[model samples]
Target: MRVLRYLVLAGLVATAGTAVAAPVTYKLDPGHTMVLFSWNHFGFSNPTANLGQVDGTLVYDEKDPSKATVEATLPLSGLDTFVPKLDEHLKSSDFFDAAKYPNVTFKSTKVTPAGKGKLKVTGDLTVHGVTKPVTLDVTLNKVGPHPMMKAQTIGFDATATIKRSDFGVGAYVPNVSDEIKIRITTEAHDASAEKK
Candidate 1:
């Protein structure tokens, strides 16, 4: 009985010694992150718009990918389509109503491995005062120290599609193409490294 008790205690000690690594938090590098979206314009051609100055955080653990989390914000007031007038129109009440709802955001609920350095991130996307669930297909571009910045960084490319009407931005709907394709290229610097 003493020998059995000793064995159980030893097993418990061994298990306690094995600690799971905590996820590392990274802050989005605004200078290296971009959010671009495209939609069919009257079926003539696809036009694209860009949202500048994105900010976010990503908590990830490569050893335990399921622990990954993401939160991002995009200011709709910074929307640009190259054409100044069209840019202004997009922010007007007819479209995004940027004055009323200035920012769009996403907070991940689940992170699932999708094979080959890819992840399927399911999250809540809030836009124009509406919140909807959306999934982004993400591929890790690279992870390491940046040569120029000398900071630990991780890069990823993600894509998703959403219907504008679903977010109450349906002014043109069928005419302007309700479906919008979004592509994001992001680089994040380790929060701890940023202090140095």
Candidate 2:
């Protein structure tokens, strides 16, 4: 009963008096969101991969985007490069060692407006048990009506780059690229609907 009441109170805070209320929270739809990363292969071409099951929440205030925040968590063992054998090897102790560290996460501390709907989100990115401050260049794509989903939606694209060595994931180092580039395309479903 208490949980149900709290849920209702949250919904109330999310929607005060608007047809399309500004979302106090946006739940990440993993099916609609993507997490991608790329690294140089032994000083050669860049190898790209899709990390699986990134889930999180986003709190947004359009009128005051500075109040916006995003949090994401990805299972480290779910790393993939389309090759089963390679994926397994990467998850072993030689590389990411998913056994020891099973997840990587990011929690935004601040969202500063950079330009028109663009923001520089400063956050702590934890990787392989190492935490470091990182900055993500985020672009708010759009937020409004969605004819297909029958719900308000928010879209954003973000990018951040970091050195693998800094996070203690340094195995290949100079042989392969130490720099890892992370890209995220978020499609969040706003359930903060109309409030009376």
Candidate 3:
């Protein structure tokens, strides 16, 4: 009976080992993902610009949040500031120099759980041909099935602040408010769900 008990215990251990969940990869929905940035204009007002056509992938492990990772790309070609003349100037050689450095990117290096449904993501942000480390405060808004798309989906809202000078985009430091505030909202869906 002792040998039988030992055999059962070993089998249970093997079963438990195999039961560990693997990470799930979700594709960011370009239509729903948006990045907005605002900066002070000579202390008069804050002007905001929108960046669209965002694409990326997020890997998440529910069992171990630390194993999560994020990689995203933002195209400057989609930048819109509402003012046509200002938009032309921003995309010119004065500010972002979008013609030379066409894309901004972020790749997370570490992910730490801050609290329930919240995370602190540390990553390298590349803009205007310069790279700098930035930390984003992220909230996991929801993770569930999308009723309309009929797929598993996840949503996140994140915020961060960075100095334009750090990324070589400082055209007017004090006047344009050296610091820029950024907000990002994204919805991702499991690409594998489409096969079902």
Candidate 4:
């Protein structure tokens, strides 16, 4: 009977360990997450646009970071180029055609640990009704309790270069530059944590 009791206790301990090592779900904080992209214009200068109001969730496993996954959506309505006419023109059919495809989205298919606090995230990016595979080099900035929000938060900075022509947003191609550089910064709060 004593031997059986010891075995049961061992099993319970193992189960508890597994539970503590499981993945965690974190919801992106829209107010703290933003996407920025820049493109070269006729070899003269580079123009940037900021996109906000991102909605997404991230499933992260600190014990096994390779299993992490991320999905995000950015509405075109939130895009700002700091120029009203430029923003309107970009949303028009000449560019993104926001009336038809109003949002840009990305869903990770695989995540690989690159180095200390770094990951290579490969995902499908949908833009202007076209979907393409893109890889983002991501660096984990920090993961801890937020000072103001009073919740556990994880932050990351990611960057990627994509060709606009490949996504069917190829207006003025070579003139406006087909390649676009994208940078994303996000802070996600643990969904299971209570905010005080």
Candidate 5:
């Protein structure tokens, strides 16, 4: 009886340890997330654009960071260049062709610790109906209760560079610039906590 009791207690302790390391899923807060991009315009200036409508889910486990995964979607129609005409032109067939390929998406393939509060995220990014692998240098901004919403939230800032020509969005490649820089800032709330 004594041996059996010890075995049961050991089993319970092991289960508790697994539970503590389980990953938690967080729902992206569109209001607090922004996807911004910049490209060299005719070797003159680097112009920027932002995607307004973004949504995603992130599963993260601080205890086992390798288990983290993220999937996000951005509507191409929401691209804003701060100029109405330029935004319209970007959505036309000459650029993103938003009428047909309406959304851009990314799904993380691997997450590795790069340093303190930083991660190297490799993912597949689909833009203009072309899919390619990209890596983002990500920094963890914060992870705790949000001051405004009083909810558990996690924030991150990530950046990546991609060549537009590889994605089939190359119009005037050498002139308009083939390389685009993307920066993303996102805050996600714990979906389970939000229900309460």
Candidate 6:
């Protein structure tokens, strides 16, 4: 009976060890979370551009794989294609129409952990009154305390190739690349717990 009791206690301790979770949260470091998009104008030439001001949160469970999720919003008015005159034109009804639909938001419905620190994030992407299924190819670059802010944060690089025309940004299609490559360099920390 003594031996059996010892074995049961050992098993319970092992189970408790696995249940302890690592601190994980990703607060969008707006200064570091860059939303960039690019397309080919004619042939192989790819013109790249970036948008400013993306806000969001990324929650990760290092021990429990099923509990991870992401939520973010990108302002449509912030989209910049590098040309100042063209930028103004883009905000009109012919394109993003910032006056009407001002923001693009994403909320994750599923997160699957792939080996090599990658995530297959399936989520709803809402743009211009249209909500569609979008998946972000997320690679967890690093997860730890921030050197500058001194808070726990996770760094990731994500990409999603989407069609602007699908969201009714259909003005200059065929002439412009139908496939837009969107890239994000994201650093996330917990909003309530982060110092900076």
Q: Model 3 over residues 7-99: C-alpha lDDT tens digits? A: 999999987665434577889998998899999999999999988898889998877888899999999888889898888888999998998
Which ten-residue region of model 4 has the weakest summed lDDT? 187-196
What would the per-residue lDDT of candidate 1 be over residues 19-68, giving only the tens digit for each residue? 32446799998898889999998889999999988888999886788789
- The 10-residue segment of model 1 with minimum total lDDT is 15-24
| Per-residue alpha-carbon lDDT of candidate 2 for residues 58-121, written as tens digits (9 for 90 to 100) | 8888778998988989997668799888788888887888899888899999889999979999
Which regions in candidate 4 have their CA more than 4 angstroms from the true location?
1-20, 194-196
lDDT of each: 0.90, 0.84, 0.90, 0.93, 0.92, 0.81
- Taking the tens digit of each residue's C-alpha lDDT, what string does model 5 give over 88-140? 99999998999999999999999999999999999999999999999999999
Q: lDDT of candidate 2?
A: 0.84
- When summed lDDT is taken over every stretch of 10 residues in candidate 6, the lowest stretch is 16-25
TM-score-best of 2 and 5: 5
TM per model? Answer: 0.88, 0.85, 0.88, 0.88, 0.88, 0.83
TM-score of candidate 3 relative to the true fold: 0.88
lDDT of 1 at 49: 94
Stretches off by above 4 angstroms in model 5 are 1-21
**lDDT per residue (tens digit) for residues 84-109 in model 4:** 99999999999999999999999999
Q: List model 6 lDDT by residue over 88-132, tens digit each.
A: 876788877889999888999998887778888899988777888
Location of the lowest summed lDDT over 10 successive residues in candidate 3:
15-24
In model 2, which regions exceed 4 Å deviation?
A: 1-23, 192-196
lDDT winner among the candidates?
4
